[model samples]
Target: MFTRRGFVKLLGGGFFGAMALGGYAFGVEPLARLSVARYVLTPSRWPSGLKLRIVALADIHACEPWMSTRRITSICERANALGGDVTVLLGDYAAGMNLVTRYVHSNEWSKALATLKAPLGVHAIMGNHDWWEDRTAQKNGGGETFGHRALAEAGIEVYSNRAVRLEKDGSGFWLAGLEDQLALLPGRKWKRASMGGLDDLDGTLAQVTDEAPVILLAHEPDIFPKVPPRVALTLSGHTHGGQVRFAGHSPVVPSRFGDRYAYGHIVEYDRNLIVSGGLGCSIAPIRFGVPPEIVVVDIG
Candidate 1:
């Protein structure tokens, strides 16, 4: 029942539709939603009367065309207003590749974060890009500083393969963080790809005691499977919600575990995993289906 003219029209329409979708995914949608996804974590060990508000920012690639230092400062101000007990940054503060070159100084970004208000304190960890990008090379002429010093200088305690205790209303739990998992790149020696050095889960976990509850921060979500169930929760970022979602499914997830560990919260066996979509883009400046986000998780 179709005529030649009708078929041509159909093809033309389909082409335009594809173009429109691409525009939405790459340009329009990426900027449209600074979505906030919230979750409630009820750990049995956590007393009911007390609650912890955690504001997590991930993959904040602080450079031009995407996120500048000014933009990051705005994000920090917004996070401060949220009135969280703790603030955590999951890394990737600077872009690894050239989307734009006028990269914001890491130290400046940290100073902006210094103004963030959290009674429990603001903590950070590095992503693979932070190491491989060589942001710390200029300081020690390429020794392993990672980007920890910048954040730390801004008063944000940057932890790698270490544990620290956070007290809330006289009850405290051990909060731990790990170095990036795929830390060692193919041609590197004695270093993680971040080149800030290595990831030592065993070393970090050994510092924690069995009596207190533990929440571990590991940047890459794929490491969740390796985390012990005894740890109450593992918070991570790096997937960027697969960076683009179509029909509610994202095809670009970079995890070794596929989309299974891609984004948001997941539970396998008795262990829990929380993977954030994070806040910025990596290589491509355009995002189609996925909108940038800041995750606010409540734990009690």
Candidate 2:
């Protein structure tokens, strides 16, 4: 029932709409948006009277003009105001994409992060990018990377397949961190055809000598299925909510589980996982429906 002129107008409108959407995704969301995604849960088997507040920052991917040191300091200030019992850095602090004006060095970014304050102190774990981007560490087949050293010098504890027991008001719980799941990439120097990881889930959990409920920090949510019931909650951020979610789904997800572990609160078999959309771009500087976020988890 449309005339030729109307048809042409419809085509032109659609073209401009697509261009507008692309512009917003590329130029606006990833650069200017920061949101808070919060989750409050009483996980099965979590102790009744022990309440904990955890503030988490993940996938920083620091670079000039995108995630500058000034911006990171502002983010840290905001996190401190949240008054979490503990602060956790979920890694990927290095630049994740080539479309950057300049990469923010580890020292600059770590120094900015040093301003964060929490009662239980700040704990960290490395992400795949933290491992993959460190050429010397990759070549050495698991030695200290600049990322680890920078974070350590900044007074943050970087956990690598390790566990630590923390106490709050006469109650204690364990914080376990797993190594990056995609730590090793295939190359001639490595002499491997497939990607391998340094993550040690079972070994890390075995460090628990008592019946304290545990909270696990992993870079990627793909490990959720393998997480045992002993862990009251699991936190991760690598997927970035697919970085460009649309219609309640991301067209392309970096995870092996596709959109299954893409973002937000996921509970399976009484094991809870919260995946943050994160605070920087990866592969490309683009974001649409899913904006950058700082995740807060309150658990009992």
Candidate 3:
């Protein structure tokens, strides 16, 4: 059943198909396409007359080769143009994941992000990459600081297992950033370890009562199930909108919950969760149906 001509044709056809698919993934898919995923959520405890517009930026892995300073600046400009009462950045601001080629310093990118302006202001939280910096702090020293330092320089408050009351015109809600639990898992070897994991979910929620509308900033959506009922909303990244999807279905997702919490808005236990399709690429720099986007949520 095998012939020399038949085998050659089969091989040639397979090669062409592979090239075409790879070309699309590497060339056409990575272009920055912005879209606004809007959601209207009214928390039972939301203060009357207090309208909050929330913008979430996640997984902006501003690596040197992939994400340059000028590009990061442009990203901030686009985010600012959208206009939100408060802007939040979910972590992984480092240059790259898995292997590093050209490293993008956090401070420089944070300065670019500082340009993002809003009346309520901008906030951020650390991802696993930030925690990796802490793991290598002894060798890298201050240079390893990723998430908090840069954002702080840009007048953005970095939330780590803490709660802050953001007030606007005498009305506001409690916005909190939970620590990266994955980064701090104990007994984890080789670049993935934490001295003391301080997620402190209970302590973080202690400041907010049952009657307060709480918006949570978490890098991973795995925390969704653990979140108490007080938190009306959870904004997260690190999913990268699955980065690759076929027919709106992603075969591989970096979540313990699988497709249950992969991307987009998920309403579970009466809590609304929004996971963004981030600005930059990670692991392997290829994306399919899932394009990079900025999410704007309006809630009153």
Q: What is the TM-score of each candidate against the true structure?
A: 0.90, 0.98, 0.86
Tell me the tens digit of each residue's lDDT in model 3 across 1-300. Answer: 899999999999999999998877766666445566777878666788888898888887877555677878887888888879899999888744644456677778888888888888888888876776555543342232556777887888888788888787777689999877666434454354543344668888897754557899998888889897788788989888788987767888988787778788888877788888887788887878887777889887
- By lDDT, the better pick of 1 and 2 is 2
Stretches of model 1 off by over 4 angstroms after superposition: 135-143, 189-197
Distance from true location, Cα of 147 in model 1, Å: 1.7
The best-first sequence of candidates by TM-score reads: 2, 1, 3
- The better candidate by TM-score, 1 or 2, is 2
lDDT of 2 by residue, 1-300 (tens): 899999999999999999999999988899888898889999987788899999999999999888999999999999999989999999899999999899999999999999999999999999989888998888987877788999999999999999999999999999999989888888838797877888999999999989989999999998899999999999999998999898888889888899999989998988899999999989999999999899999997
- CA shift of 183, model 3, Å: 1.9
RMSD (CA, angstroms), candidate 1: 2.9
